[model samples]
Target: MIKKAVIPAAGFGTRFLPATKAVPKEMLPIVDKPNLQYIIEEAINSGIEDIIIVTGRNKKAMEDHFDRSVELELLLEKTNKHELLNTVEQISNLVDIHYVRQKEPLGLGHAILCTKKFIGNEPFAVLLPDDIIDNEEPALKQMVNHYNDVQSSILGVKEVPHNDVDKYGIVEIEKSSTSLYPIKGVVEKPAVDVAPSNLAIVGRYILTPEIFDKLENVKPDAKGEIQLTDAIESLRFDQSIYACALEGTRYDVGDKFGFLQATFDFAMKREELHEPLKKYLKEKLEE
Candidate 1:
């Protein structure tokens, strides 16, 4: 069972622009709760007992979110808002939240390395908040089930257009089966025509702890950053790595357009806003 999960929230959300100037990107709300909260809930529901967040400077908002706010609790206490107080308390009680500082923005590999001590010897899930998945069974839970059954590290896969393969980690298939396929290798941002497959490795991953060592040995790739895909591919010679096409809609909230789309779609899913938001969009469309 994957008991530990790490969420790396140290990146500067440059795509969100002026709004993200002072705010942590993870804290941006899709509609109600912060974006990171969605990922946290998903991890908790997937049976991840411990959540280790790798944060950096100016990311205190991320830390304070998981911690108790004594002042606000007192204010709510005076107001006698019992329900609100309970909701506030729920944040700290949700799960065991641990934090490690990533002092440098070396790469995704560095972010994972920051939590080495906390992960110890167990397999863990790494969920990137940028990729918000909509599924009946949470994406991580689905991956976890696959990992337990196969006893192999798994990557979340989603088919993309051939031209877009260069935008992600493209997989090279070595063996194919009914459901699972062994990857010969993975190339991050390979040129469009040279990509081996259109099945791109998404942000969700169930990785063995041994990835830490592979990450340590990998040299910096094209952009002078240690790409985690490079490390995962390096492990192919010894470890069995598998990919599963995630069973739902995945919104790449990292981009500006995707973020706006997530806000619109997520808001449209709420009982309170669905009809009204749809009507509003339809009216605007007519205009």
Candidate 2:
């Protein structure tokens, strides 16, 4: 029962630039709701009860978004805005969310290490909120189901084009099934000539606590940042780690193009926005 999940939201979104100067990237809204909220909802839907969000400076907005506001609720009630009120109220009650500040700008592995006190000896899921996954089955839930059967760490993997393999952490897999692969090796952003496979590691992960020990032994790179990929690779020495191919569309919302694509896809799915957005896209295409 992997009841706890950790979300690393501390990164400085230099990719988004000026807009992210003050606002945390996780707070960036997808349509009307913040991206982090969607990630939280995904966790809740996957039966995750305890959520530990690893945040950094100027991340109060992320915290506030999940907190209850009595005045706002009362005002909504007075205005008879039941729908809006329910939406606002539901955010606070979705799950047991806890926040921990990552005082410095460390790497993904460090941010996850911060949750050791909370996670304490439990196998936990790590959801990078930026990788918004849309599927008939929530991505994390699918990973969890697979985790139950394998009882090993699972990494969400998706097939990328051979040309794009250099842009991602490519996995060297041995025995491969239709939806799962036994990860024999992992290289972070390898050159095309050296890429062992086109299976790229994505954001979602179900990690065992032994990873903490591996992370502690990991040396920081030239940028003075620890790489989670390195730690996971080190853990491979002790146990079997698998790459579970996701049965869904994954949008790397941290990237500008990916964000726009996700917004358009999600919007098109809405009944009210479908026709209007489709008409607007057709009009723009004509120009």
lDDT of each: 0.88, 0.91
Query: For residues 1-287, could you state the per-residue lDDT of candidate 2 as single tens digits?
Result: 88999999998999998999999999888877788988998999998999999998888998889999899999999999999999999988989999998888878889998999999998999999889999989999989999999999999988888999988878898776467778899898999888999999889999999999988889988888788999999999999999999989999999999998888898899899999999998999999
Kindly report which residue stretches of model 2 are placed more than 4 angstroms away from their true locations once superposed: none
- What's the residue-level lDDT of 40 in candidate 2? 91
Global fold similarity of model 1 (TM-score): 0.95
Q: Highest TM-score: which candidate?
A: 2
Weakest ten-residue segment in model 1 by summed lDDT: 173-182
After superposition, candidate 1 runs with Cα above 4 Å error = 174-178
What TM-score does structure 2 among the candidates reach?
A: 0.97
Give candidate 2's total backbone clashes. Answer: 0
TM-score of each: 0.95, 0.97
